[model samples]
Target: MSKRLRSILTPIIAVLLGIIVGTIIMLVSGYNPVDAYTALWNGAFGDVYYTGEVIRQVTPYILAGLAVAFAFRVGLFNIGVEGQFIVGWLAAVWVGVAFDLPKVIHLPLAIIAAMVAGGLWAFIPGLLKARFRVHEVIVTIMMNYTALHTVNYIIRTKLNQGSAKTGMIHESASLRSPWLQELTTHSTMHWGIMIAIACCFIMWFLLEKTTRGFELRAVGFNQDAAHYAGMSVNKNIILSMVISGAFAGIAGAMEGLGTFGYMAVQGGFTGVGFNGIAVALLGGNTALGVFFSALLFGSLKIGALSMPLEAGVPKELVDIIIALIVFFVASSYIIRVVLDRFSKKGVK
Candidate 1:
């Protein structure tokens, strides 16, 4: 097989192996695997409404995945995407609710605030790592908690304590498209999917076509070497983190402005940021890969929510399936061995 073909086939084979294993787990657990799968399919694609919701759910995942994938590409592990996502969501919501600008100005401005907030959140850790030699993983993890609590506090102390949600956003700031609802039957899916796709293209362009992306990758691969080659490692490191966070922020904004439309004091963290890790891995941390992986994740999530109602199965089983899939995907040696065995057996 060609190297390119192998690259593609490896992941597909791994995914199939994961599903087979998951079926065994279900059978052992005394659950009907076929029924569970049927429920999952119905939940995800049974009707237009469900399919739209699946797309909507994955929209944020795509953005978050892009954020993590971008950082990984540049040799940075930005665990802080969670915090950046929260800050971005809060910031975007704040802009949407607090401002009175025309839609032309208001919508873009609110989204931009999220990008800035998320970018700045990442900038701190990036700068610290570049200048003071701090471990970015630790700093980013801490920041994630900080962002969660900070947003919670703001929601209660400043944004609103009594109300679970902030004031409704201005019409101009809303991303809802009324016309599409007629087709989807008033589903939650909005324009965010389009934005996520756009980001994928943008990510590809920036990384493959831009000089700045080259510098960032260089710093990521070898900071000392990049420095010796006249690239400012500090600048690239900071830039990479900032851009990663910015993408995460836009993701948050998409969820907030495009879907939720207001900030509610979240009782706890939303799962988007953390899920980005899996998304990054499943996507292979590439722009196009992230896009397709996001769709898979989104569908799984949407389908999971319906299992309890449709098939008397625990919703959490989805997590088990996801874990298995990720494990198989990340462990290439295991999959390669399996593939070799299959090939020898002529299992085609």
Candidate 2:
């Protein structure tokens, strides 16, 4: 099988296997798999409201997935996306609440603040990795804790008067659209989806049609070779993390300005950044692939809520299915070997 065929088939087969395993688990747990799946389907796309919610969920997933995939392309493991996302959300909310400018200026300024915060948050680990050969994964993981506590402290001491969250952002700084809400029957959808889609195209163009992208890819493929070719490996590494963090920042902006319109103190990780790793993996780490994979993940997340409400199935079952899918995708070498054997036999 060709590489392209293998790439396409692997995720499809993984998804099928996940569904099969989920069915068996549901049966063992005394639930009707058919009813459960039907409910899941309905919750995702049965009405305009649900569809809009799915799209809204997908918007952040797409940006977060791109963040991870971009780092992967540069051979960097950016475990700090969660931290970056939180800081970005906080920064955007700060700007949104503090400014009283016109809609165009306020909105763009808030969004830029988000991107800058996220980028700067990631830059610390990137700088360490590039300048001191520090392990980025460890640093980023630690940074996640720092970001969590720091944001909580800021919220308690600075932003919130008595509540656990800052005030709602100004209307001019918000991403919500009244027309879009009416069109989607009041789903929490926003213009962030358009930004996500535009980022997808930008990612594709940058990675596939630019000299800088070639350098980044080259550095990722072989640092020694890239150095020999006069490419600045350190620069690319820093640039990659910065760009990846920017994507993740926009994801946070979607949650802050578009979905929630406020920044809240969190007791734990939001899981969106972590889920982006699975999205990137399932997408084969490509821009277009990330877009579609995010949709699938988003659908599962939104639909999971209906499983229990409609079919008496546990919502956690959906988590199991998602875990299985990721497992199968990660273990795709086994599938590839099996396909190769079949191809060899057919050739004979």
Best model number under lDDT: 2
Error of 2 at 335 (Å): 1.3
State the lDDT of candidate 2 residue by residue for 1-348, as single tens digits.
788988898888989999999999999989999999999999999989999999999999999999999999999989888888899999999999988999989999999999999999999999999999999999999999999999999999999957899999999999999999999999999999999999999999998899999999998899999999999999999999999999999999999999999988999999989999999999999999999999999999999999999999989999999999999999999988888888789899
Sequence-dependent TM-score of model 2: 0.98
How close is every model to the real structure, measured as TM-score? 0.95, 0.98
Kindly state the number of residue pairs that clash in model 1: 0
What number of clashing residue pairs does each candidate have, in the order they appear? Answer: 0, 0
Leading candidate by TM-score: 2
What candidate 1 gets wrong by more than 4 Å, as runs, is: 336-348
